[model samples]
Target: MDCMFKKIAKQGGDIQFDDVETIIGPSVKLEGEFQSKGNVMVSGVLIGKLETSENVRIETNAQIEGDITAREAIIAGNVHGNIIIAQHLSLLSSAKITGDITAGSIAIQQGAQMNGKCSMVATVEPKPADVKQNAASVMQDTTELL
Candidate 1:
């Protein structure tokens, strides 16, 4: 049991995979939001949002029904919500996406089905207090001048 625990731990908690980079199985189903600090490979059905600081890889047989917020995402399955990626997004041949996508880079395979808008954008940092204050003051002064 100790060895089994160790093996499972190495594969990332309760999720099991033959390869750390691959998630392939038929009977898996996940519900509710999932937050991961590392990469995620999903081959099952997920009914909630996926949040990852690294990359998210969804296999061809997988189905996700909620939003995805990640640094990068590679999808080969079905997605039904908005995708907000900081870096890159790729849709493979079997992908079926039905919502908007915002990412720094994107790639769509030939046979993929996509029905949404895509925007290439950079990550934005919040303005510092000084900058915000200065801008507000400038705007006020301009309005007064007008």
Candidate 2:
């Protein structure tokens, strides 16, 4: 295993490339939507949306020019679109990201560069009904005081 894999293991996660169902080789260039239910690894250039139910790995020298949605991701290349990771995201030192990110958890190395918004998926937003109930309760209490 490489240092990146070791780091992931230390963080209590495992990504096995041996089981990867899709691989975009370094010399290949793709220009359309790519969807997969299993793991996907990219070592080339992709210019469209990437959606995967399993993990996605972007290796060094790779570049992606569209949005990505995955259960987890490890990025060591360049990405120019939004990234949504349902579980976790790891940005290695070589990563250069230029769009928003939404992830349940994220880990960025010291040299990783990012230039957009980041939202945590673990945050809980109150439902509209709940907010309305709380507001009404507050109004009732104020009226009682009056």
Candidate 3:
């Protein structure tokens, strides 16, 4: 597991043939919650939640029916559930996603399909005071215009 994560961390952001801690083959079907401490690669069908501490890769023939939570992900398959990624996410040309996505950053290749909204998350949140100040300034500007 440690070796797999080291490979994931050392590699560039592109999803390549990195070391995998878990691999689900094309003939297998998995149900129930799947958790991993390292990288996961799936080429099969999954019907439950997937949570990974590192990266996740879904191959072109894969199909997933539940939510996915990962630090980073690359999808080249069919997914019918929401995805939450803490870092980078890439949807390849063959990917089809049917649910909303939340990620720190995302890249969608040509021919990729998505039916739901995508929201980008920031690594650092603004301070409450900063938000309040911005809102107050905006309100003041509007009032002056009125």
Candidate 4:
């Protein structure tokens, strides 16, 4: 887990996978909107809108079939929908986005792919939370996913 954030020092490395409140595992396939106030990390298939007030990380093997709205995002997978970020967004080399993008700032790696229009918006500030809570204690519908 520590190795994953080594290259993401810019966001202050404040959000980690282990500290995520909602995690969609690689083998799980979910079909519903994901709304949360806390950070989320998806490594599987999500077939609905995802909105959050915090950071989001979409892993290399993940696949998203709907729009994503978040404060910030780190994507390294395939996204079939639009993305809107309040702050910075990083699209790794393995990322493949097929929809429009709206973000305050963006970093695209050499091999990243995005096939739609992009717009930059004004971002006031960014402040990721420092508190971490166990996923098991989270009462969200997607918690403790099997």
Q: What lDDT would each prediction earn against the true structure?
A: 0.75, 0.87, 0.85, 0.83
Provide TM-scores for the models: 0.69, 0.78, 0.75, 0.76
* lDDT of each residue in 9-113, candidate 2, tens digit only: 416666555577888989999999999999888999999999998889999899999999988899999999999888888999999999989888898999999
| Best of the candidates, lDDT | 2
- Of models 2 and 3, which has the larger lDDT? 2
Would you list the clashing residue pairs of candidate 1?
none
Estimate, for each residue in 35-139, the C-alpha lDDT of model 4 and write its tens digit. 999878888999999999988999999999999999889999999998989888889999999998989888899999999998887963322242223333464
Write candidate 3's Cα lDDT for 26-111 as tens digits.
99999999998988988999999999888898888999999999888988899999998888888989999999898888888899
Q: What does each candidate score in C-alpha RMSD?
A: 9.0, 7.7, 8.7, 12.1
Models sorted by TM-score, best on top: 2, 4, 3, 1
Best by TM-score: 2
TM-score comparison, 1 vs 4, better candidate: 4
> Can you list the residue pairs that collide in candidate 3?
none
